[model samples]
Target: MSYSKPRNDYINAVIIPGYTYDSKILVTQCPLEETVVDFWTMVYDHNSSIVVLLDQLNRKTPLWLGRQEVLQFKDFTIVQDNSPNPEELKLILSHKEKDPMSITVFTTSKVNNDAILPSNVLLDLLKKVTECWKIQKGPITVVCSDGCSKSGIFVALKLILEKMKIDDEIDVFQVVRTMQVRRPEFFTEFDQYEYCYRCIKEYLENDSVYANL
Candidate 1:
């Protein structure tokens, strides 16, 4: 089955935890010139469905789009001091019904935790996010911290596309370049890039074979 091409002309929005030179470069280089919304503070724009942030840390902050424009949502912070059960985390996410978009804010601790989010959980998140993009009339822009630890999300996204048999149409290079512009530190670690590349390649090959069968 073929999926429709993503509406690439829509404005791209980026979510970052804080202002950084790398993040600035990403915004400047992004292909979407007309609607590049930056979320410096924790604010949401209903007009733009895309939400980008450095990591999950800024989920609670007020989303300030521009002067006099403030969007607020129930803030959820990762439990760092004490690790909460996954059920507890799910309950926290379920509390906000107003926001149809599932919101998740995590820290590096999540990357470290072996049992925090199982591989299946990550895969499910990727599938859900892509499904959202398929239904929406616009392209999906993801903003995350730069590094190997943070690379899991993108890897998972690419896997989802591959599984759906649309990997060829996806521009992995553009995605990586856009990410590099957002987080120069991401490429500073060669190992992280290698890991991300390997993960994507493995997922694509495996999924492509599965689709063929």
Candidate 2:
């Protein structure tokens, strides 16, 4: 089944295969004010419980609701539950009469546009998302303002980390090259290319940090 609905359903989003599942990722640009409802519909329809908001958005109203606050948009209602950190939000998305789905929204402002996230922070974020996926077992939605470099790099590192766990090997080059075929704008910069290798090396150096992951 395709996580990507028809063009009319949700625009500017595409499905990308993940390390363990065939169609396990939905990479998209930050939703515009007018398209926010469509974005939530995509999440609701796809049954995605994890949302990785890579960068800070410039919009007036934040996409997520505040603690214990709820917002309604067309057929969707978003409720924000308490979270341990401000960076991670627990959201419940409900459509009309269907069962409400709990989604974890991981947001990081440390990554500015075109800027790479620090290796340690990126790995920590990846580990959290990975662990969530391990228990939930579904597609992850990754969003960035422009939906290219940062989001793509995040997914690339995720796949690389998964590959390391399964095969005990790392091939940053091949993983990136393959993802680029599906989304041409992924990992577009040379620095981003180099950052992947740096992250892998860092993960190796601090094995204990992610020992459980």
Instruction: Give per-residue CA lDDT, model 2, range 117-183, as digits (tens).
Output: 8988899888888777778878899998888878888888888877777888888988888888888
Give the C-alpha miss distance for residue 64 in model 1, angstroms: 14
Question: What lDDT score belongs to each candidate, Candidate 1 first?
Answer: 0.34, 0.81
Show model 1 residue runs off by greater than 4 Å.
Answer: 1-46, 50-122, 139-175, 178-186, 205-213
Find the 10 residues in a row with the least total lDDT in model 1: 86-95
Tell me the lDDT of model 2 at 38: 75
Best by lDDT: 2
lDDT score at residue 41, model 1, on the 0-100 scale: 15
For candidate 1, lDDT tens digit of each residue in 1-213?
111133232333333221212111112121222122223111222222333232433333332322223343233221112225321121112113234333332223343322323443444445554444444423233444322334434543443344335344544455555555545443455554555455456556666432321
lDDT measured at residue 103 in model 1 versus the true structure, 0 to 100: 32
TM-score of 1: 0.40
Q: After superposition, how far is residue 163 of candidate 2 from its true place, in Å?
A: 1.8
